[model samples]
Target: MQVTFETPDQPDVHALIAELDAYLYSLYPPENVYALDIASLLAPNVEFAVARDAGGSAIGCAAVVVTPEYGEIKRMYVRPTARGQGLARKLISALEEKARAQGCSVFMLETGPTMQEALALYERMGYKHRGAFGDYPEDPLSVFMQKVVA
Candidate 1:
């Protein structure tokens, strides 16, 4: 699989994000789902990327939004058929690298408690539990994490 910085509005990438949105909505209430929409992903401060298979099919995607304080991860999703092969790790690493290149040493993200696999992956990647930051209010359904890259 190949992970590269790309536009999120492409057809295949849009499909991937839509699938992710449906899954998240199924698992959480609207207020608990803080995913960035396509237009938001296209913002100047956001860096989005997609993971494609050898045949060039978009199978996974992620984005990092740069803020004055830290890089915030958003819209990270890997298709179900493409899971268990480290695609999520690859996508996240690519975004982190992009952030690091831009001089962002700290990374933060907000996920849901019900997403066990996502929580485990974040923990394995050295993300520690933290309180809500930015404009996010303290919500019981939210899990906030942060990582500092050297």
Candidate 2:
């Protein structure tokens, strides 16, 4: 597995982001979803990564939002058909490593309340439940989790 980081403006990066957004939209109605789009995740503070096969075709991607204190995982998605092969975990480890290089000591993320598989992945990856942070309001539909990356 190869994990590569790049500015979201890259063509391959944009392709992954488009696929991610389309997948997310298929999971929920646009009005009911809180997912970020390609442009939003391309903001200055956000660093993105792509996990590729030996042939270098992207299989997964993650966005790590850097801040002075901690980092937030955004737009993390592994193709549904690619689940159970550790692609998601690879994307996560790559992002965490990049975040650490950026001086971040903590990692946090939010996922839909009904995403049991994702929630399980977070738990298995060492993230613990936490109260809402940042612009996230305490809502029954959202689950917040965090890890100490330092």
Candidate 3:
């Protein structure tokens, strides 16, 4: 597997994002969903990356919206077939490294409680529960977390 920085508008990336969007919307109300759209991902403040398999097929993707205060994780997803192989961790680590390079030591993310595995992963990765940051309104369905990189 190879992970590299890439634009989010590619065909395969769009497919992956579409799948992730569908899955999230299915699980949560539309108002509670906060995944960034293509335009948002393409904005100057966002950095996106894609993970490809040995065959060069896009298997996963992640992004971070960088700010002076913190880097907010967004659009993190791996195809169901690609789960359990550590791709998610790799993608996140890459994003953190990029954020650190840009002078950010804090990382924040908002996920849903229904995603037990994701919440567990974030906890294991050293992110502690926190209140909603940025423009996100306080919502019962949202679980926010933060980590300060050393």
Best by lDDT: 3
Cα lDDT tens digits, model 1, 1-150, are: 899899898999989988999999999999889989899999998999899999999999999999878999999899999999999998889899988988999999999999999999999999999999999999999999999988
Cα error, residue 83 of model 2, in Å, equals 2.2
Q: Can you write out model 3's per-residue Cα lDDT over 67-143, one digit (the tens) per residue?
A: 98999999999999999999999999999999899999999999999999999888888999999898988899999
Q: Model 2 — which ten-residue stretch has the worst lDDT?
A: 27-36
lDDT of candidate 3 at residue 97, scale 0 to 100: 94
Q: Which ten residues in a row have the lowest lDDT in candidate 3?
A: 117-126
For each candidate in turn, the TM-score is 0.98, 0.86, 0.98
lDDT of 1 at 95: 90
TM-score: the better of candidates 2 and 3: 3
CA lDDT of each candidate? 0.94, 0.82, 0.95
Off by over 4 Å in 1: none
* lDDT of predicted model 2: 0.82
Residue 70 of candidate 3: its Cα lDDT?
Answer: 96
lDDT of 1 at 110: 98
Candidate 1, position 26, lDDT: 97
Per-candidate clashes come to 0, 0, 0
lDDT for 130 in candidate 2 is: 99
**CA error at residue 137 for candidate 2, angstroms:** 1.4
